[model samples]
Target: MPGPDLLSSQGLRLDGRRPNELRRIKCKLGVFTQPDGSAYLEQGNTKVLAAVYGPHQAAKSKSSTDGVVVNCQYSTATFSTGERKNRPRGDRKSQEMSMHLRQALTAAIKTELYPRSQIDIYVEVLQADGGAYCAGVNAATLALIDAGIPLRAYACACSASMAWRAGQPEPLLDVGHVEEAAGGVVLTVAALPNTGSIALLEMSHRLHMDYFDVVLSRAMQGCRDIEIILDRAVRDHLAEGWTKQDIVTI
Candidate 1:
């Protein structure tokens, strides 16, 4: 449960947003030409980049006759967190995050379309302020789209936190690091918002069953909001053209 001090008397959270408000989202697609597809997304203080590769032949161990295999890797920059980390990858936490990312994205991708092929999606967190996982999911979704990989629907992720203010249960959408560290149950959901299908649902700490619906609903709304932001970014990037410079004779 969250303490009263976490919420201001003016009915605003620490970051000055209403309980259901999400952080600002800014994103760009096809940011790197080197990769098959690449995207960068910023969710408040969190920043993430995702790159997608293939629909090509699968690796020996991962090949499958039934469908394409989706391989995912999640890594964070050394300066991403408040505390500096030594290595970028191969750590226990990174390994676990990579596996979870694979599971969530695999559920949304249309794997059967390319049998014996593989699609690789890698996410790098350049800055973290909580909800890094959600940002990675959104960035990966855009990268996959840029890569021309077929997906059933846009996969998005958002987090919700339970806060009690004045003895009232309030669910906060898109928790930041401060809110997350405030000792409350954080519910992270990855879903296909358009289809109303959930791909992943993870909750930390504990919350009463009665408040679950409200918190889950808030997270779903955040996902929908994020999808709109990402869509706009893709369109904007396309409209901007190749370079910031204008060609032609001065």
Candidate 2:
């Protein structure tokens, strides 16, 4: 559904990125002292903050015997977008995003290692250029790591959109707000790329079967690319000493 203008004649996107390029990502861990873990991430203009608490005692009703419970809350600041949205807490969209966050995070956590405990993750969208959910997922992953939580693998998320360039089809990585607003088909994927497994996948608007595989692969590739960046950040943090507790701006 994207207009022809989505891609220029030079095969560059509206944001001047190549089809396979990702927006520059900058992130920091240990952003706050209060939370057991906290991180801030910015992917292009989309910014998100994530905090993690617990693996502590869970309420009787919500306690799980088989594995640790994962509770997630996703919120958006009123000023995050160009238009202010004075929505109440637990709005339908926020609740849905919270659920999606839990789904993707649970896949990476070693839940069975801590039964009858709960891990609470809170993510707030500070800016919403596009792909807020994906940014939240990436930020939460860093927060969990900051908390020293064990994991099966890194959980990463990315999105792709289909566009037409010079009469041929193209897949766009890291869809920006402009591209998202163009009414094009967007596919979002969360995965454990190291383990070769998918955590969550969502799409807005229908896309043809012929184009589905390519779009999905592109998103997966983005995840793999992001994981490397995150790993390097963690390594740098370790080298600097986690006890130093400085905000790592990478």
- lDDT for model 2, please: 0.92
Highest lDDT model number: 2
TM-score for candidate 1:
0.93
Tell me the deviation in Å of residue 78 in model 1: 0.8
Model 2 pairs in collision: none
Q: Indicate the residue-level lDDT of 75 in model 1.
A: 95
Evaluate all candidate structures by whole-model CA lDDT and list the values in order.
0.88, 0.92
Q: What is the C-alpha lDDT profile of model 2 across 1-250, one tens digit per residue?
A: 5567888899998999999999999998888887888889999999999999988999899998999999999999989999998972488999999999999999999999999999999999999999999999999999999999999999999999999887888899999999999999999999999998999999998798998999999999999999999898888777878632443432
- Assess the local accuracy of residue 47 in candidate 1 as a C-alpha lDDT between 0 and 100: 99
Please identify model 2 stretches exceeding 4 Å from their true place: 243-250
Worst 10 residues of 1 by lDDT: 241-250
